[model samples]
Target: MALYNAAALIPSGLLSVVFSLASIFNALNARVFFGEKIAVRVVLAGLLGVSGLILLLWDSLTVSFDPDTVRGIGWALLGTMIFSWGNIASRRNSATRTAPIIANAWGMGIGAGVLLVLALATRQPLVVPTDPTYLAALLYLAVFASVIGFTTYLMLVSQIGSAQAGYATVVFPVVALVISTFFEGYAWTATAVIGIALTLLGDAVMFGRFGRKRAGKILKLT
Candidate 1:
């Protein structure tokens, strides 16, 4: 939340870079701190993901930072660190006794409880519905984003390995931009178009096409 609020002041490009770098650094920490060996494919995927993010936000990369952006950067870094730790822990938990469904339900329930408690304590409005649009937004977030996306992603992690499954998130901005263009009437700049191309290319690199014999060979090497 803090990081997102900070993002309002910071350039989106810088925020993306900061988050990407944090995740990469956390992956490195997985190797050093947790003693999980880093695969070459994972490293290459990280590079491609960050590069794509850079290309995606190339036009906004020049914005000067303010105090809020600085704070936002700190939050972004910390949030990612926490997130990485959670990922590692969740993976470990899955490897142990618990099923992924139970783990996810517990985690989400606890998180929601914490947020609700905080909101109530601070007198924040839990539901300030001015229109039916708010209900539709809630339904979309609950049904599509939270329920479906998380469920599928966790399943993907178990099947493909977390590092590979993680690459799916790198395409979120591409989806967002496409939606914005169609629904919000966003103008497409040449840079934006190029960014989308790069993002898709990066995804292809991260998730090598099934028919690519060379990529299959590389996976075998890994």
Candidate 2:
């Protein structure tokens, strides 16, 4: 999470696009670390989702690059790798009977301690925000994103294998885009439409929403 926040300092939309690769890393880690057998459909869905992400951000990524942009992308990739490891850890902990809420509380506490130490060592100011908006945002992040969101995701990791659960990262961008359209005045382009369609299709495929008969036919062909 620290790595992810660090990467957000980068000014390039490409950083956001690259970060979506965490889903791929998560799937791979589930196989390597947990010995989870990845289904063909899952791989296909991941590929489609990644392709959609590329299309979704292709325009933003075409901007002229700088050394800082390159470095930022590297940080984003590194963060994504670490995030995948976190997913694996969550899955492992859940397997060992650690409740999601308990695991998240401990994990968040330890992470906060590490960040506090880092801030102190760096001599960063630890002043609290006075702005009501800032405080509200922080509260929302703490409650919705950190608590509810993570708990649900960890629960999903326990119910489904990590590979399938990792698709959440891929789906997040689509939601962000919708929010951007309304709140940030983002324009919907042809490429974005196609990307959204592909992303939805990938999600459907991942969840076996294509129907059992269709899945069986595809399986037989493969």
User: Cα lDDT of all candidates, in order?
Assistant: 0.68, 0.79
* lDDT (tens digit, per residue) of candidate 1 on 146-194: 7776766666666665566656556666677779889999787777777
Query: Which regions of candidate 2 fall more than 4 Å away from where they truly are?
Result: 1-12, 209-222
Would you give me the overall lDDT of model 1?
A: 0.68
- Pick by TM-score: which candidate is best? 2
RMSD of each: 3.9, 2.6
Q: In candidate 1, residue 215 scores what lDDT?
A: 54
**Candidate 1: lDDT of 118?**
88
lDDT by residue (87-176, candidate 2, tens digit) is 899988987999999999999999899989999999999999899999999999999999999999999988986777888887887888
What are the runs in model 1 whose C-alpha is more than 4 Å off? Answer: 11-14, 21-26, 32-34, 120-130, 209-222
